[model samples]
Target: MTDEQPDRKESGFKETTRVRTARERLRETVAGHDRTERVPLDAADGRVLAEAVVAERNVPHYPRAAMDGFAVRAEDTFGASDRSPEILRSAGEAASVEPGAAVQVHTGSELPEGADAVVMIEHADERGGDLEVFDAVGAGENVAPVGEDVESGQRLYDAGHRLRPSDLGLLKSVGVREVEAYEPPSVAVIPTGEELVAEDPAPGEVVETNGLTVSRYVERWGGAATYRDVVTDDPDALREAVERDSDHDVVVTTGGSSVGERDLLPEVVSELGEVVVHGVALKPGHPVALGVVEETPVVMLPGYPVASIVNAVQFLRPATKWAGNLPVPDPPTTDARLDRKIRSEPGVRTFARVSLTDEDGERVATPTRASGSGILSSVALADGWVVVPEASEGIPADEVVAVQDWEALP
Candidate 1:
């Protein structure tokens, strides 16, 4: 474990704090400690599996017909076609099963005990008890053999796989009524600071929107947002909230993370639990904090709306996925030419909101004005954000940058 001691002189900010690289800080924040639960297949949508799901039996269960036609030995219809037809009488030699077969089978019906192929209805003609066969089919031409779709004892899905609609259908087809899935990690979000309030506040009071946004993200990531409330910038109150909400797997507190007299979140977190990480080397979200309270992971984020959200993407999102036993997917990215130059401080990763538009049949990005930490509206208005690496001072116009997707493309 790397040290998170304060390194105030690195950035020349009035308040100096130790900061870890984005990846290092994220690694220090551990996943929630929780067990698995069994959920019905229908309710397991979007949930991650805790165990492998194996097929109990083969798909289709038996060899079946694949078309409405006569089931017969492929050799019997040899040289059969429009110009060269084979006439076979339905006498004692070939019993009259249906209009033209020893026995006619509809599509999907089980093939007769000895049949190896099906002669489609279009390939046969009935003429007063005498059948003319044409368009000969080879063996296994129209037969769906047992285990053709899936084999018995096959591992249909492995642990840590997120269930999709198609996966549900496959599970249903394989007769899986319930599955072992990781229990949804319970999360408690506490929005702190005297300037914050749950309800509409007087002028200058910022409404508590971070908790709502965090809650939605938690739910979307397959974790349950069990509690959301506001707390004043008091270490005692914050400690009380942590102790009371220790039942949850993770607790999040927004605001009061900076090293100011009013910023007592760090102190409260340390008093109640162990502070693992204090800050991150990322623009708009440098004050992000990580700790553990009573064995439950606790994350403290900056008060600014954009900062909170960006930190959520960088930290909370992955933590939720890990808690749910889900295999994390690479963050969505797209390549587009930069429309203008954007500067950034060295040694800090920057996420800039950008609007993607089609200019003369090419996709171009327009950086939004709400690139600041306080602007939440830009997140909704922009298509996605562009990630600027710490190694580069800035990105020049016409340079191809990978833009993260925020909404469905137009």
Candidate 2:
């Protein structure tokens, strides 16, 4: 709350805010929204649970055979061997196993009553209505007892746990039909700029892609995104757009955030609400801004494609997670050796796109040729990006670094 506010009409930031401070303020503004909904198990994957899931019934309601075998009393198979096999009368699928009698059962079949163990068909021989066991069996062997997989009243998952494919399967096995899941945050993605068009852009006119890109990412990050039409850089239109979508959990406007005269999002946002952060000390996206309107967090991204995407990952993603009561997942990463040195500003964090390759016997990361913020292909074709800390000037060649997969979802 104490961060100095940049002048709305200022052309550039004298001192940018740290990435951590911007994120903290953004999270604080959007946190504590606890809306939830009942979601069927089929559609619950990747959703965050709103409450603990308890098993109401055992996974295996009855004791069953784990594999195809003959059910027999443990005592009947004791001392059984190839040289002196123990012989028992065949019960032939009887409802229950009598002492010294064996009942046939298949995999997953209910274990016959009175059967303490199972002798595999491979270890037993059938001869004139008699079964000869050549292997000793212990009680409960080759059988799946009741509650073996999930016991009744067992807590399967706690609040904030993200559901996966296997998690849904297990929940269904325990008689769970649906789950109480946090509702995804709603976002309005508005791309601004007078020179932006939808398609078939002529000279000096750029196709409107920042909104499309940011909206898609909003959905991928577990937010319901309403992709709005491209709004002109006029202050009145920009303010109207923000006010129109203020009901949403978050409002993200891409472009028109820089210091150029055409860049007007920072000023527009200031008029309608308080801008928490005007610029961040991050490479390629320092013009990004964060604000709050009617208790809803607003994220203004840079006009450049790469910078917009980078700021979305840094600010919008976590804000959406906080609003939806979902836990933010760490991006997936891989360790690789840098093929070449990467220069970076000492006081700014940098995300240098790189393509991974195997050279000789080592995994090497080669920086992309088009590393500028406006170069969409640089990030499009890159496998991941190597992060340079604010304290480091550059990473030397052959140094091992963790490459973060920007598109990965947890």
Candidate 3:
């Protein structure tokens, strides 16, 4: 761990930082910080609200027909049926209905003035513009009243709310062309390591892929990602790349935060700004690093693919989302019985990937490979992660484990 000898040949690695503290600091660093933009309706999907979206006008602003039929007076239609039908003159489309008269109206068409009810087309017969009503309808039946969906001056969404597709429809219904929302964070993913190759790595070299993977993760987390070239394991080179990427909202570096000989992210982050954490108390992700450089949040992920993915899910994803005031992408959770024993080191929070299946009317979880973090297939073949609390040593077979990141409950 000395400056002269950057590559320390040490066993077990010297890790001093805790995971929870690092996450707490990251939260503090990113909370309530983002720029607002008045984005057009077309580009506002998945963006968080920076201001309340008040209804400019009532949804359906006018009384509209809810069915294709005749708009009539409910009292007039009473006592009218197939056997003893009520006869009335039709006023035609958009025409006002006189007493004992009906107006032709289509679904979603505005109800003619003085019309209080609409009899569906199936319940009424239109013969040469003349109307014969068979079924009676109550006042306001099959009619969308004024402000039926949203009232004018009502706030449809509060600040910090994320916009969905349906939310855009709501705004469009109220004639909102654009909305003020938090801009998505711009992230830079920089992969660092001397042994890393751009592509087609031989036996002695490893392919650099964490940046691409992290860039995609950042994009999925509602951020614009710029994947930077893989910087060699040099403090100056890493520091320069980080400085240049500081224009972005956040920077995520991979493959040099651990206590290994070539791990250099912690030192570079410290020299550039401040290293909030250099290690974590989580298994596989224990080498995750968190920091802030030039007020830009920097997340140094472990070199291992699984570790990088897990830590990205744990830290970077939320940071990117929160920087833009976006909501967290909360995965569905489910509980299942362990199909076999899952072991973990006590005092280290573990995330064991497991594939679950319904066997004998019960959900059974089989553990994935519990080897080194470089094993990507271990997690890819699995459905969800089973959390092993720091206080617990191991979970025995048949024990019900909550799959916190599960897509759905079995």
TM-score of each: 0.88, 0.96, 0.88
Name the regions of candidate 2 deviating beyond 4 angstroms. Answer: 1-3, 6-11
Instruction: State model 2's lDDT.
Output: 0.90
Candidate number with greatest TM-score:
2
As for candidate 3, its clashing pairs are none
lDDT for each residue of candidate 2 in 304-357, tens digit (9 for 90 to 100):
999998999999999888888778878999899998999999899999999999
- CA lDDT of each candidate? 0.76, 0.90, 0.83
Name the TM-score of candidate 2: 0.96
Ranking by lDDT: 2, 3, 1
Question: The CA-based lDDT of model 1 is what?
Answer: 0.76
Per-residue lDDT over 30-69 for candidate 1, one digit per residue giving the tens place of the 0 to 100 score: 5645598899988989888888999888887888789887
As a whole number from 0 to 100, the lDDT of residue 152 in candidate 3 is 92
Provide the lDDT at 242 for model 1: 80
2 or 3, greater by TM-score:
2
Model 3, C-alpha of 39: deviation from truth (Å): 1.8
